[model samples]
Target: MTDHEDDLGPRVASFRELRGMSLRALAAAAGVSTSFLSQLENGRTNASVASLRKIAGALGVSPAELLDERAAHTRGVLRADRRPRLEGALGVEKFVLSLPPLRNLEVYAGEFAPGASTGANPYTHGNAQEMFVVIEGTVVFELGGERFEMSRDDSIEFLSSVPHRIVNESEAEARVIWINSPPTPDEAHGA
Candidate 1:
């Protein structure tokens, strides 16, 4: 197996431990065999994409998060120019504002061009908390089943599990800061 597969095993085990899940419990939750799970965790075997997805779901994280190297170490200072930028979807651009090895919290900065949006459909995370602060212009946020319009300096905090989407419906571009507690399961690669 490749080195990444070997590294993946321990990371999966770590996340399982963080969630206070036993091998059997996680195996059952992911609908995988205990032996297979053990072998995967011990680096004796590699996992397929579907297996990784199942395990990540059972661990309350995204598959990509389980494979993220940035989640393994902590950085004290994050220079602005050094922030990692993500290849955004739609007209939205995102940057990781926090240093590596995200533990309890993560911070991000996003810019949405006029008429841009997070996506057509809302997405949900696991049991975490999120805060969004509008830095400039205006944006509309749909959280749960309600829609809230926010302007510069406006902020809102909500459960990450709630289905949500952000849209920049204004004539000008909008900027926002996104903060997540207990960090969501998304990978951030630094520039």
Candidate 2:
């Protein structure tokens, strides 16, 4: 295998393992044959775009994430301008503060314009833990049917499995820092 392919195989295998999926399980989820997946993971074959998409979908990540060269590097200090921004809801902007190999943790800085929110519906992740800290302005978080209002310097942490949504009702823009442990794969795609 070429160097790139060699690097890709281990990454695919590592992500699969991190999700606690066996080869057969991942193959089934990705709608590919177990043998084919084994070959791909062993660097014996390359994946087509369709296959990569399927694999990424099954892993709850974007194909771009699987293909990112930077994902292979571990940068100790990420510059402000170098941080990757995430696609968020209207009036909300999110920037990733953490670097590659996002297995254990993720940190993000978010700015929410007035009246912005994480939508009306609440969302949930698997078993990850999350913390949100308000840097400026005020925001409210609704978690598991309870509402909590937070202001500058205030923080909250909880299991991400609980249904939650964030809201900025103030007239001013709100800024926050979000930290997650055992980062959710969907977050990798800015979901």
Candidate 3:
């Protein structure tokens, strides 16, 4: 077996442990057989992304976490004005937004270029109240049935439980820092 197979096993085991879930119980939740889960945990089988996703969802985790400790850890934080950018879905770019990584919360800075939007789909996250502090320009915040406009230095805090989206209609880029305490909303669920 390749190293990838070995790396995947512990994550499976970790998930089971974190939820205090039995193998049979987790299998039932994931729609997989107990024997299959056992093999996957022991690195005897290759678990597909779909299986991993189901496992993650049932455990209230993001699929990206399946990478776990296998990825290298960065040595230090990226400085202000030097924050690395991660582009998310819907053509949005999320900058570090100038916040350090601490235990209880995660802070992100994002910039939406002119005409960029979070799209029209409405979705709910586990538990998060995203506080947006507009630092650069104006943004139209759409939360559930309400819409609000925020300007420079203006802020809006709301529960992330409902569907929301942001639109930057101006010709200039919209910069904002999003702060979330207890980073993972469904953190009460798993590893």
Candidate 4:
């Protein structure tokens, strides 16, 4: 793990603010306490691998990015498989498929087990937009008063500012590639 990964709170917090998520909101989304997140961000404590993965997921980064600022500063071609996975709750799984720092946008590929999701209630960001495709198994998407049953190769794109939910009903694992960009408040803005 890199220094940031070793001391993940501050970097993770920075990305939270970047995404316009409150400590309470992020803590809720990551399945951790706000106080714990505060401590981590303040550099008063070290995060577990699970915790780091959750924070990285919420921040739309790979677990490795928090540790390796070098990648954040490195400018060149990067391999998709080499990118890091963002951490989430104990049962949830998410990762940035491939993203370079300072780019104004972020993309991710996430896997949710049979009963996991982003969180209990939906979350919103500034002008945020997300698109996801079910690469395998089935994904249940609740967006804008619609319940979409997405199977393999099914996809949906919408304003993330709207409340949403995701679920995997298949006996097999559910895999989705999601892209989130420009934060929240930008939802009403032009594409």
Of the candidates shown, which would achieve the greatest lDDT relative to the real structure? Answer: 1
TM-score result, candidate 4 = 0.52
lDDT of 4 by residue, 1-191 (tens): 55555546666766676556788888987888999998888887788889888877766677887776554333345576677766665456777654533345666677778877666655555556677788888878888667899998988888777877776666777888877666333232211
TM-score of 2: 0.59
- The stretch of ten residues in a row with the least summed lDDT in candidate 2 is 68-77
Which model is ahead, 1 or 3, in terms of TM-score? Answer: 1
- For residues 1-191, write the lDDT of model 2, one tens digit per residue: 56666677777787776565688888998999999999888888999989999987887667776776565333336787888988889999999986553457878999999999877788887667899899999999888999999999999999888888899999999999989887777743333
Going through the candidates in the order shown, the clash numbers are 1, 0, 1, 17
lDDT of 3: 0.69
TM-score of each candidate structure, all chains considered together: 0.58, 0.59, 0.51, 0.52
lDDT of 3 by residue, 54-168 (tens): 8766655656665565422222346766876765546467865423223345577777888887666645555776687888989898878788888999988877676777888
Identify the runs in model 2 with alpha carbons over 4 angstroms from their true place. Answer: 1-74, 187-191
For candidate 4, the lDDT comes to 0.69
lDDT of 1: 0.82
Candidate 4: stretches off by over 4 Å: 1-81, 183-191
Give the CA lDDT, 0 to 100, for residue 148 in model 3: 89
True-structure RMSD, every candidate: 10.3, 7.5, 10.7, 12.8
Task: Itemize residue pairs with steric clashes in candidate 2.
Answer: none
With a 3 Å backbone cut-off (N, CA, C), the pairs that clash in candidate 3 are 97-109
Distance from true location, Cα of 105 in model 1, Å = 0.6
